[model samples]
Target chain A: MNENRKHDSNAQDRTDRDWDLLYEIRQRVIQSVAKNMDLFGVTPSVGRLYGTMYFHGQPMTLDEMRDELGMSKTSMSTGVRSLQEIHMVYQTWKKGVRKDLYQAEEDWYKTFIELFTTKWRKAIEINSKEVSNAKGLLEHLWQNTHDENLKRIVAEDLEKLQHASEYYDWLSRLVESFETGEIFKFIPKKSEA
Target chain B: MNENRKHDSNAQDRTDRDWDLLYEIRQRVIQSVAKNMDLFGVTPSVGRLYGTMYFHGQPMTLDEMRDELGMSKTSMSTGVRSLQEIHMVYQTWKKGVRKDLYQAEEDWYKTFIELFTTKWRKAIEINSKEVSNAKGLLEHLWQNTHDENLKRIVAEDLEKLQHASEYYDWLSRLVESFETGEIFKFIPKKSEA
Candidate 1:
């Protein structure tokens, strides 16, 4: 009976070690994803929550996530909500469960398209408006100025603004295409056998 | 003669007003560009220098840029050098001028391609390496573990890392296509008569 007990303890020790290793791996991946998300203007907590849900591969409740991630309930709720708004996470229903369960989308391509299109489209729209304003100001200055050097300078700058405006307009459309998956249509796919 | 002098003075005042308006416009554009560059992890000074040179539409000496932009000689030199390294700015020689003159590339398409390819490729490369490391650790755990729960969890997480690594690899290739202008070939052009 003592030998059996010793064998059971050894198995439990091994299980603990395995859990430790898995936890270490999960932490590293979460950190990496969080760092990358920082580049895209996302908070580290949001990335961490998403990464956790992704690897968990099962719908998790807010309390479960909060406990597992050692985050406050408020933080977990906010992060999960933000992820849901971005379509990175979604709600899942479990039979006989009243609380909502959330799971990571796991579709990286769709997630990227949604994230970048929203970001780039907004950026392009802002820039386009600024370019237009600058162009208007320059044109007004050009018309009112009489000096040859100043006229030439204003003309050149106005041209640059117009060029930039056009490019941003084009970029906005490109981002729209990205959203619609039309941009991918341009990419060549391998021929099927 | 007194009346003529008054007229000349009035003309000078108008020129000054025009210059003031142009300067204000330039400042606005520079600020906008600097803010956008911040998103890409570039310093504000670099974006300002690029905007100034782009609007100037002429090769400018470092001293000239420093004096006009109210920046220190050291900052001007460093900003210009960084811009040159990225191929956004290039040195040009003027006849009878001994000092090197720098000018903005002014080709927005080329500039975007060069800047984004360099930044995104580095990001993808780093993420790919991290994903591979995570995958290795997970595979190691999977092999060493006998518990079915741990095995299933590691297998699922391993699949995620593999998927992410593949996506990053594909994105790196897409950036290469952008560098080669092969991606542009896929873009539909305006019909020519």
Candidate 2:
């Protein structure tokens, strides 16, 4: 290796130039992703941290991530935790590595499906239960009331509840499509061509 | 009509009880809707304003909404304006009515479709354009670079861009599914029964 030092240095210089160009292109993409991550319910800074890790194209330890992004280690951990909670990032066991190494889930479709479907499903579960309970209460009122006025009001409320119940059922199916990847049949994840 | 004064008084008391029960049921629904409105990106207070108006079951003027929700009139206007921009609420002219009247869009499915489809579509447009531009620049670099190492790096980045482009295309179709109501066929707005 030492005998070819002169040739290796030239190769190294060109290699550095190639890497720099790659970085420049990936940087803009990182910026774009970071700016739009409010849709993911994360702060822009946290988004930037994830974007940087993603574009780096390799698993990184917390210290390396903090150094690369110049973020406080605490903030990086917080961001990583949030991403983990959403299943957007996860720690991987690197051979013989003592430090925890993290990798971004590169499939954007899967990321969107996990984060959004979970959120909407949770909301649907809680809201639908409350709605069902309210419906039951209204139905009970309707049965107990001898007065025409109470019955009429309860009947109208019951109709409104019925409409809302239908909406939740539709939303639940929408979440299931994403969770089950049934949506991909309609909207293919890869380009057909 | 005044001849049945005693009977009318009894009917009015029962009517008030009926109205109170209706309000109780609707209030919980409104509260459930409000708690989940963070998904729409508005503050809870703003969501509460919309929920109150929605359950009010009529076109309400700004003053009326403020009075009903005990919010400042300014906040009511702000919330209404935000909801209107997102197509969740709208202004309607009531004939012979001087004040501007606002109505909540009652169809939750349509509301979700409009808000999410627009947001995801806008994001896809911007991100895909930037990605295409970056891909073009990398191709330009690939063409000029004689170095094998540089060529390899450019090729890899191009593959990454290709993958990302595919995801964006899929997301664009997802937005279209919502906009065109293609998703409704998959997840019907009404229950099958």
Candidate 3:
């Protein structure tokens, strides 16, 4: 009986040590990621929320996430909402809880591409439109220009604008293909048929 | 005398038409670019200031840029200061002008590299550090594990961490070389360059 008791105590002691170490390491990682996100103009809460979802590898309720990330309910709600807006996160209604559960969209590339198209690509499209309008004005002036040197410069700039627009159109088409799950096989296979 | 009068009037008329067209085109391009920038959370004044410098192909004084982009003195001053903070705009003292002239860094790749390293890389570095800590935690847990199945699952996660760290390292290296301009030459030179 004494030998069994000794073994049980040793196991408990070992488990306690392991848990302490794990918590410490996790805290360090969380702190480091938070600092980095701040540098990128991302809120620290956003980083923590992404980091937690990424590490969990499963959907977690807001209360669960709040406990796991050591975040307040308000911070988790706001951060998760922003991440969902950026398409880096998704929400699912669990059967029991009134609160929604969230998960990081596992495919990193797709998440970034979605963000690019929705946010970054819009900017590019605007720039392309501006360039086209600029080309039109330059063309109008070109018709009146007799100077060979000025005409050559204007012509080259117009060509550059055309190329930029063409490239953007091509990229937009390519990205549109990834909107559905077909193109990216990188996503882990869905278990439920 | 009649020939001279006709020629001079025609030249004046053409010049006036060209200036008017240039002004109109310039405004359209500037406005569109500004709108895109606003979508990305950048101010219109800041976007216009950068857009003007980008298309101008050379630096201009606050006065010159104000005249060229048709911005007020107050608008140009505020915009230039904001761009300067982000290192997207650089100021140089002009020989004739009383104040500093601002220029856009012309090399798109180099400017992107600078922005990535200074702003984005910091975030990556923090992520890398967190990944490292996660690695340490996994190692500790792996050593402590008696359940082979649970251990295998955790080991797999650690392996993913290893791969993720490598990716971040590779990205940082790529961005680092970009600042030197050598990376662009190594790749097939884009026509824009």
Candidate 4:
């Protein structure tokens, strides 16, 4: 009886060690991703959610995530919804459970491209307008300035603006290719399904 | 006298029109940048501050920015500090102002290089630990699996992580070039001083 009890305690100790390691990794991942996302203007909660999904190693049901992250059901529900809208997270149904399982999208680069072209595209569009306005300002300076050097500089700026449009166009095409999954062929993942 | 009154009113109306246009541009630039920043995982204020500085045509004094953006003094102070910390914004003294003026670094792409590398370096460090943990999991699967295909898949995953590190290295080099100012030389600006 004493031998059996000793063996049981040893087994429990091993389990506790495994849990501790898992917990530590989860915390570190969360902290690093949260800081980066904060810089990127993504919410800490969103980073936590995605990091949790990535480190967890498989799809996790909402209940599992809630328990793991120690978050309330309402917060998880809203966070998962927001992640889905951005195409960073996806949901799938489980056979036994009624609750939905969520996972981070595997392709990091493509996820970034989707975000860039959709949300950041607006900024680029606004920039294009600003560039046009700057051109007008340059033209004004060109006509008004008696300084020959300043006039030449303004003309150079005007030409640069015309050529810079090509870079933006190229960026748009790169984003399109990522969105269409052309980049995935190069990635060599373990499995698709 | 009646003609003089009409002329004054018309002048006032045109001034109002110009103010409205500037206001509209300010608001759109803020809103667009705010949305992009959120998508990227940084704060809305960071986006607003950077966008405003970028479009302001030249570096601006903190007080000048406060007036232009119509933000509270405290908000501008915090936003400018945050931008400076990220290396996206810089602090410089003007000839007249006692207080420091803020400027978006001249080579914007270099700033982006720092941002991307700092972020990717963090991800790689964390993922390296994850790869170690994953190795244990793979070893466990190798011990347990009778199925050759599943074992083969795990081996492929292991191999992919090795190759993926090469991609990360390549990406690092690509982003590092942004700091070298080669791209900036390709596009001419109106004037430096």
The clash count of every prediction, one per candidate, is 0, 0, 0, 8
TM-scores across all candidates?
0.83, 0.88, 0.67, 0.63
Best by DockQ: 2
Please give the CA lDDT of all the candidate structures.
0.82, 0.84, 0.67, 0.62
Evaluate candidate 2 and give its CAPRI docking class based on DockQ: medium
Show pairs that collide, candidate 1: none
The reply for model 3, stretches above 4 Å from the true place, is A1-17, A34-42, A69-78, A92-99, A109-119, A144-193, B1-21, B35-44, B55-58, B63-87, B91-98, B144-160, B173-193
Q: Is candidate 3 or candidate 4 better by TM-score?
A: 3
Error of 1 at A28 (Å): 2.6
lDDT over C-alpha atoms for residue A95 of model 4: 85
Q: Arrange candidates by lDDT, descending.
A: 2, 1, 3, 4
Model 1, A5-96: lDDT tens digits are 99999999999999999989888878888777765667888898888899888999999999989999899999999999989999999899
Per-residue C-alpha lDDT of model 4 across residues A1-193, encoded as one tens digit per residue: 6999998888767656554544554466456655555534468887888777865657888888788779998888888888888888898776887778888776655566677567656656765666566556666656765556545655765665554444445444444545675534533233333
**Would you list the clashing residue pairs of candidate 2?**
none
Better of 2 and 3 by DockQ: 2
**Candidate closer to the true structure by lDDT (higher is better), 1 or 4:** 1
How far in Å is the alpha carbon of B72 misplaced in model 2?
Answer: 0.8
The sequence of per-residue lDDT tens digits that candidate 3 reaches over residues A1-193 is 6999999988778766665665566566656765665432357778777866875777888888888877798888988898888777898877787878888776644654476456656666677777877777788667867656556656765665565566555444434534554333422233122
In the range B69-163, model 3's lDDT, one tens digit per residue, is 67698888888887777677888775777777788755443444566556656667778877987998789798876656556756766776776
Tens digits of lDDT, candidate 2, A1-193: 6769978898788768777887888888878878888887978888888888777668989999899888799988988999999988989997899999999888888898988998899889988998899999989888866678668767876887788889899899889989988888878876567
What's the i-RMS of each model? 3.2, 2.7, 7.1, 8.5
Docking class of 1: acceptable
